[model samples]
Target chain A: MTKPTGPSRRTFLKTTAAATLAAPTIVSPSIFAKGDTPAPSDRVVVGSIGVGDLGRRHHLNNKLLVNPRIQVAAVCDVDRNHRDLAANDVLTKSGKMPGVYKDFRDLCDRKDIDAVFVVTPDHWHALVSIYAMETGKDVYCEKPLTLNIEEGKKMVEVARRYGAVFQTGSQQRSEGPFRQAVELIRNGKIGKVQRVDTYIGNIDAGKWQAPITPPPELDWNFWLGPAPYADYFPNRCHYQFRWFSDYSGGKMTDWGAHHNDITQWALEKDQSGPVKVRCEQAQFAPDGPHDVALEFDIAYTYADGVELHCHSQGKNGIKFTGTDGWVFVSRSQKEFDAHDKALLTWQAGDNDVNLPRTETKHPHHDNFLDCIASRQRPICDVEIGHRSATVCHLGNIAIRLGRELQWDPAKEEFVGDDQANQLVGKPMRAPWHL
Target chain B: MATVTELAGDLCSGDQVKTYQAQQALARLSGEIGASGKEAEKAEAAKALAAVLAGVKPAKDNRGEATVDSIKSVNSANELCRALSLLAGEAEVAVLAECLKNIDLRETARWCLARMTCQGAADALVEAYKTATGTEYRVGLINALGRKQGSNVLETLKLAAADKEPEVALAAVEALANTPDAALDAVISSVESGSSSRRAARVARARVRLGSTLLRAGDDAGAKKVFTAVAGADVDEAPKKAAAAAVGG
Candidate 1:
């Protein structure tokens, strides 16, 4: 935080880092960024999948319509309520009610839509995207890429085969410090990037079961989707999925996909992978029906000798360790000092307005749209999302198997151990096939 | 390092000679250091940053207005509020408050109304409330003024507390806690309103918080007055809620 305290002001447009990721009332990634936007022309006919809590938030935060270049054409969710909210929002804004669907597949099958936004839980990320791409629709899938490693790889394969521009919703790469940290590390600011200390807030692991009380508004079976069926815990659906093993990788993937992705990016590897992972978890909180690890520290080592340390702390941020002084970045709108500002400037010292630029204008979505329009890879591409997600899945696998496992970052698989290898990809419950 | 007066003068006076000198000193201090852990050096760095402010002109709008025009060019309410807040203290606060009235910068007027303790704030807050009716800024104005003059402003606030509007009534009740000793009992009694009692409770809570400020300032009598009220009352209720905010010994 620049000028941490006081009523007076002087510093040149410095803001705290915490405000960066905060979802303001109804922010669409569109409402913020200044110039990366290209005249808001050539609209992408977009549709949504799994419009529950996240569906509404994504719909609200996406500034695609503000560009006048994008149109939300269809909405789909297991719940009519979820779909209606998004459809209504689009209808109200654009004077066109989107075709609503109770089944995501129905939405994915549509030929008119140019893009599909898969903001469903981790499990549905792969299933919906695979189908969306099969039907010739481009996709913007939400974080943790997929439920497990193999699905992530498959999703990547399908995306590549279909010639679809797949952008993962790991928006951190769209942030300035994250990009700056990577640039500094890639350009050798931290010298030889040897270690990374990543903190993504607290998330405890284990089973959580709430009273099977079903809200009249909820469609529980459809909500559970591909996951192994459990009692209808409303908290487990829509919002609290991050706390469970079935749908989410706790905060490891929730916030980890964000910070960890930056850690790996700063290490100069998006297509490459972290070779080994060891996990140490502490279950400090009682399992109140949520299953993700609450307090844990997982250390990830790259094959080339770089080690990334990820831990759940009270605060959330990413710290990159170059051989020199480390640069710590919080996912906030905090001001950068002259030193931090230098980290954001391009290696060329001008027009580095891409991901991790110095300006505080929220530019994540604009980058995605720019890539979509230009048919270029976005700052956070599908491969980058899979790699970041692999870090989280590997940590989960180590913790779940109660042992460390060697990984092939190149093949995207576990190395010698058959038992741990099996856990890399999970089976999708029938009727919800990917 | 420049003295406080020199820092303030360099900031307000449009003197380039002083500005250039200050910037050079700041750059050297920021650049020459290689992470010295010495407390004195850190203090010196802070002093250098402070000196930079000496010639720190008011951060202008992209349009170069000391303040943006309310009728046009502003994009977000937050931006407007931020500009108003910047005007509150970073530069000339009173002038900004006065400007809001003529320009009809409603959001900025409301923001500045609650924030300012300068002499012009009281009149502005009252006017903003009269025009906007049922807004939070009026209470922010009354309470901000109350924090400055306490009971001296109680009679003026009593009308606001009794107003038919609930939010304004709540603000009046809050201001009541800061009322003069003569009105303290009335402020305490006013906590009976079902809708506005929480405001009274918070007012009582403020007294608890104000205790240390009074004690630190060597106003032990005022500190004791608040502390005694909290210690003797129901923990949840206010006016008597003051003790929790004070140090026991």
Candidate 2:
């Protein structure tokens, strides 16, 4: 199929000019146009995919139910019990029963559903999001954006091709302190930035889960959709799936999705990444159950001479050091810190750049809805998500290969190293073509 | 903060001196080779590349052959394809597939498409092969598609195997040799009918290879069946011996 052309350059230029001059928070009135009358028709109909922990608790019960402007039209999960629970919760809260589906495609096919909240496993992220977009539904996909680097690339391309407004679940982008830290860095409060230190946590290794029959409530095949088929075990399916490379990228991508994202935003390098990546002091379990790194320090160097140091031993946050000063912030941190405490009080002038603002339980989710109405790009768009995820994936590659690799960010490739480039995009099992 | 559009204009300027400078400016805007550019900058470069591909004409070489020699001479052809790959989709794939007809740029274009994350790229190659008039060019496109993995290209390979041109059909058969069960089934059926095996020796070898895939998948029964068939086939001695060894017949 031939790709569709985007809006003309002239149109893009005009829209950009308007966006640049507008306030940091740009919300289209159509999102709440019917809300003035408070009618059901006016409410944005949203479907919640994967009614698991975050899907049920944070997304459906907390945010979607609480948001008056949104109506939870559908809840889908491969696990029958999870979907039923979510549907029941929605009914109890909204006094209306939501349509339940065992398959995500059924949810996407609904004409009433305007958008989908994909809180599925990392491996399913790109497929579900792409399929939803292909069905003409906007998506708020959870991070890390994809299971592998190739999947992320495909997600970005397909999202744009279908004109879908995609928001990655990198909520750090929406947090107040994170934005403030980025703004401070952007305004050069930290002088010419040189290095950034990000600490998320250690990787999980040397743990094995014996194969067990999948629970009756779950459709193991559907759950393992694009991921390689494997014998089911309790630990390999749910929250613990993060420990497996086939399902997730361990803590490197898990927490790195948030911290590396902020690092990219602060460096204003969301479209690109570091040129060279190296790992030191890494160890791994010989056999499976969980096969991620034990511990390591990863170093990434940008062509323009900026450095990013990621390790597990440091404070659990990002510390940006520049010529003059430094600043640090983390989700777990009670308060943000700067070299000079007064720097935290620095406000932007009329001419200073202000990143977009989001203040909701899931700011990125709210941003997705707003962008769906405005036909604008969300704060953490698919491309930005892909780039951020690429950083984490690179760290994993460096560790796994036990070597330093030169990366060409512009080409999104490892420079002249066929072996390294091979890891950039892995082959999927049969019947699953991305 | 030079706009990618401005830099792209410089790149397409035909003047050797100005074009190199323009390429440098575009490279810098993309944040050197090793660095990452801003989102806006990346977007602009993508747009600029699209526009250049659409409008920029090929330059004349010293031998007066109409070629993109100006860009190729400076190693910018690969660079252009890389930039295009960054923002590539079906549209970019179509353009690159068309470039496969250009012998000078075919390798670079294939390399560009091979590295892309877009799945439509494989489909584009198949589409290009069907439409490609020249037997040689069609074979080249088939060879390129051969290196691609996935079942997406399976049907295309099967179709190409039926080509009236023996060369094209042979190339398609050669490509199908490494495919899994599905493609193997098609190859086996074609060989049984004595149509796909114009080069009979390769078909015997492919059968042996398919049988090997089954053996590795732990389907000894199916593997033995395939090997027995190849061993029984009225073909070359080499393939018969190979199949006999596989089945220990």
Candidate 3:
């Protein structure tokens, strides 16, 4: 299953190019060429909600998207500043002013938009995603995929019912190094890998010490969304929301989402999670300030006999150790191996990745865009998202319980222990439904 | 989610078995009363059967490699490694050697070694030695040996680094790069090895030893690519051209 490297970032680029040539009647490369974007017979329209930290960075930049014919028909976010900025950004790029809304549900009601990007926090991801799918919009969500394992389950169910293409923002799955690392593992480059040492670190408690103040114009309650209202801390809000447990699972889900996702994808365990989560931990200085595990050593054991040890190093990256040799990959320029400068030549997954009739490198957003047009599923699709996030949630559960927990992925609960089983899903704030 | 009856070696057989039996009795009693109870009784019966019959012990002192299955398979392998990883004192070292029998699982072997700290990844070296066999592997073994701490690897590595075969010696010297300043000069000679791959790796290791990574941290080489890769290639709009300024510094 593992092909030799030495190709380009699009390693299977030529094959996909040839595929585009052969599949011309359906959406193909000729249609996706920058100026020649064949319109979807019907234009694929989109709306966006909650343009904060994740939204601005992950959803607004579709101008470079290979599918040039798509429209950003509407944008919504509770924060006026974000809404104004996002609206203008879309206008400048697409040459059309999109309708703006403060209420996300109002934005979702628009029949014009066939899809929407839910770039809100962890808590809002489920609600926005489910409602959009129900309203006939495919969804693209930022990663740490869901607030918890329970929300993810419901979101997957809703997407299936509505037949929406839901993409989780695990874009690293598309990156060359990450893909190479996975391919190498899957092919036994590391040789019958047993334990993978994943270093996804912490929010380091003091990082959330900013003054507690919320801006007047922002709807702080709505921003909190499904999460319980906490004393507002500037560091605990916006992009830094990940450090707070009400919205995020600290680094367990923040960086864990990215790192665990690669493990999940490669191990072929994304649709399920480890049956056991054991957190061997240490408390941080004033650990009570943040909600999730402060500094911990945790081991996650999957049903397929692979054990993932997500260790807290306060840094990011994953090191996979197998029976053969091992490879350490990270985003940092400063590293120990520091000299394995092999370039990545991209390859298309003809059999596995199963690209649709369209030809595009932009699989993440393009999935959302294509789903809007063809009414199909995306690559880092929603169920994949929910399963990956469940891995993250298991880490949180182990940390919260302060002990080892045996999870039944088949039933999605802690085995025979009602106290722990109760923790799988969280209590949503009143008046919000997914 | 296969159940093991408290594998920590802490479960006393008589008490543990009796407690398990008592729970079984309770479930059976509950099942006698209702049909709903019957399903649970069946489940408990199945689980009990799985638990009592689950484990397989390795053939003692043979240390020849064996594949275990899980009605004892991968679960057996996982339990063996995990249980073996948790042991302490004199038994830990021998059990780790047993773990090395599965010579193919190097990464887990390295991690288990790192956790064991039995002279800084000695299990990996031992596995490399045990698996490699003959004179060709002596250099690779010596290289792996240098990955460990202590005086034992030093003399052996030094001797191998001066081997009759230049390529073997080159591998030995490369192993010393992982060692400190004591072996710096020995590793440097390999920068121009008879083998290209070995020479390139030596050069790279030497650069790493000199602390010369290709780019500075936050130098943000290929700024747009780096930024897009770090930021959002899928979603984010604002191009931080500021990222370019952060590069090449």
Candidate 4:
């Protein structure tokens, strides 16, 4: 695969020119017929895979469906009920029902779709997004970007090889408070940062539940996809899948993807990661369906001597402590606090470091669509997402192995640790390849 | 500090705390043995774990006859397999291969084998694949072979790719995508002649992947040839689009 050279100025200007000429305006309902299709050149047609909670409620209803320049062309899910609900929702909103698919491949095969929204489980994220990019489609995949370290590496490689505009749904990067805090830290408001503490919550140990017949509306086999086959249990699917090690890294990847992402950005390590990861403490759920860590305290050491601490028991946010002072930020607060109150009001100067900010209501989604038009990278590009997710995955690997791991961020391998390296990439169940 | 024998007993205690502690202790012991740089010590540790695993009786639940003891036995067996996975090498492959026959231990055993990074590991998987009865089980073994990728399993995978069972065949085709010396000519032929759209798509994907391997190895002309053929093949639009993008870029 060709190494990704980012979009050149020539390609960006060409795309911008085409976008300006064909950009769709917000037309009134009376002007455009109820069921008429928008000109292909004017609209970005989208197909959404995995229309469950986050897919339907957040990406579809709130972002994609409402955006005038984007059209929801289709929705796919292994759950019949979920797909029908999503299809009906699209119909009600757009006066035309989008195509419904039980398999994501069917949706990916559509040449008409300009892009795909991959909102599948973490295990399916890499394969689904890779197939989409291979088929020449931009992607907006939710975080954390991959189930294992190797998957993230492969996703970045594939994205760059295909020159796809990929966006990771670490929406916090586009939020007001996170951007402000990162900018402040980057500009030296927190002079010579020393440590960052991220407080993402813990995952509860799942209780042992006997296997039961799956709901008829769900295609259980398809739902498992690349994950290993297991007996069906209600708790093993939908929103609860995160608690299982096979599908997700529990809270480590769930909320850790968001908070730890801000920490990576604040430290300006978007492309690189810590050199050492140590699990200070960890507790696992009893032998049952769910095997992910229930609680964990992990510490990471960067080459520059900056320390990053992630805990399951603290305020659900990130606090960056530096030589000068400390600044803490969270979406829960919608505002940040600093030891020196004046730092909270500090503004960027002409020569100061300034981070990109999203001003729209649906900032993250808007940034994706804008980049798709300009042929530029999104705010949280694939490589950035992979790096942040690597931090979370490293923490999980440490807890699983119950030892400190020496990591080579450049090679993305554990130094002289064969057992640790084994956990880096899992062998997918048959029929799935990255 | 519990002795190895005491920790092994605790592994089957069916108490979550005790089991967790035992697993951790065993893992540390394995790591220590591995770090000691003594091949003899590593083999001894592997032998001890294998003995413990051999002692675990198979769980029975025919007509719901499974007891708490049976569940504990299986759980202990799996934990032992995980410990063995961390450091077991060619010396332990035979015992792990035996574990593959036990339905309860098959997945963990395969995982252990796949991580061995040894020719013996790949050979064990190939031997298992030859006689694996169920479709899912055969697929599992094939996947392990793919992860353990070598020319040794190329013929086995090529044969399995044409298996009558579509599920098993699909699994082989996907696995072949990862094999460096995979028969791309066969895959390309299947892409052109496969009647099923799904089969064609799978082969097309294999060709695209093989082309990528060639491209990465600096065989630019070979890669473009493969990509061009797939782009023009009567396969799904997804692989076609992928090939076109590769060629155009």
Q: Which candidate is the best by DockQ?
A: 4
**Ranking 1 against 2 by lDDT, winner:** 2
Query: What is candidate 2's lDDT per residue for A1-434, written digit by digit as tens?
Result: 11215553224433664566454554432233343433454456899999899899988987889877688989999999999999999999999999999988778867667789999988888878876875668888889998778788768766754557788989888878898899899999989999999998985544455567899999998888655455687877888888777788888999999999999999989999999999866655433346566567899998889999988677789999999999988875476899978887887776897778755555666677667655678889999999999999999888766668899988888986554676687544322435
The CAPRI-style docking tier of model 3 reads incorrect
DockQ for each of the predicted structures, in order? 0.01, 0.02, 0.01, 0.29
lDDT of 2 by residue, B1-249 (tens): 656666666555544445545644553343322223344544555656766664544455454564446444224444466446545555566667666665445545655565565677787676666666767556656666765766758778788878877667766766675565633645543733345332565565557656666776787887788778877878655456667766774
> TM-score of predicted model 1?
0.55
Q: What would the per-residue lDDT of candidate 1 be over residues B119-196, giving only the tens digit for each residue? A: 455555554445543254454455444443533355566666666655556556545544334334345445434554
* Regions more than 4 Å wrong, model 3: A1-35, A40-42, A62-67, A207-213, A285-288, A331-361, B1-249
Evaluated with lDDT, which candidate comes out highest? Answer: 4
Clashing pairs in 2: none
Model 1 lDDT tens row, A1-434: 11224422111111321243242212224422454332322446788777777666654435544544466778888777777777888788778788988877677656567787888878778878876775667788888887888788767765654456788887777665565556666666556767778888885433444346677666777777766444565566767777767788888888889888887777668898788887766453441335456778888788889888888874577666666656777766473322345554535244332233323343555555544544555567788899889898888776655556789988777886654565676544322333
Q: Which has the higher lDDT value, candidate number 2 or candidate number 4? A: 4
Per-residue lDDT of B203 in model 1: 47
TM-score of chain A of 1: 0.84
Q: Write the per-residue lDDT of candidate 4 for residues B64-164, one digit (tens) a residue.
A: 57665555665777677777776788888888888778767776688678767778889999988888888877887777777766666887887787787
User: How well does chain B match by TM-score in each candidate?
Assistant: 0.46, 0.65, 0.41, 0.87
**Candidate 4 C-alpha lDDT tens digits along A1-434:** 11225664334544664667454321112112243444445567899999999999998998888877578999999999999999999999999889999888889877788899999889999999988887778999999899999999988977876678999999999887888899899998889999999999986667655568899999998888877666688888999999877899989999889999999999889999999999999877555446677888999999999999999998788999999999999995545799899987888876888677556667788777667766668889999999999999999988877678899999999999877898899876555656
TM-score of chain A of each: 0.84, 0.91, 0.83, 0.91
lDDT against the true structure, each candidate: 0.58, 0.72, 0.57, 0.80
lDDT of 3 by residue, A74-171 (tens): 88888889998988888887788999998887787665676777888887888888767655577888887788887888788656544566888887
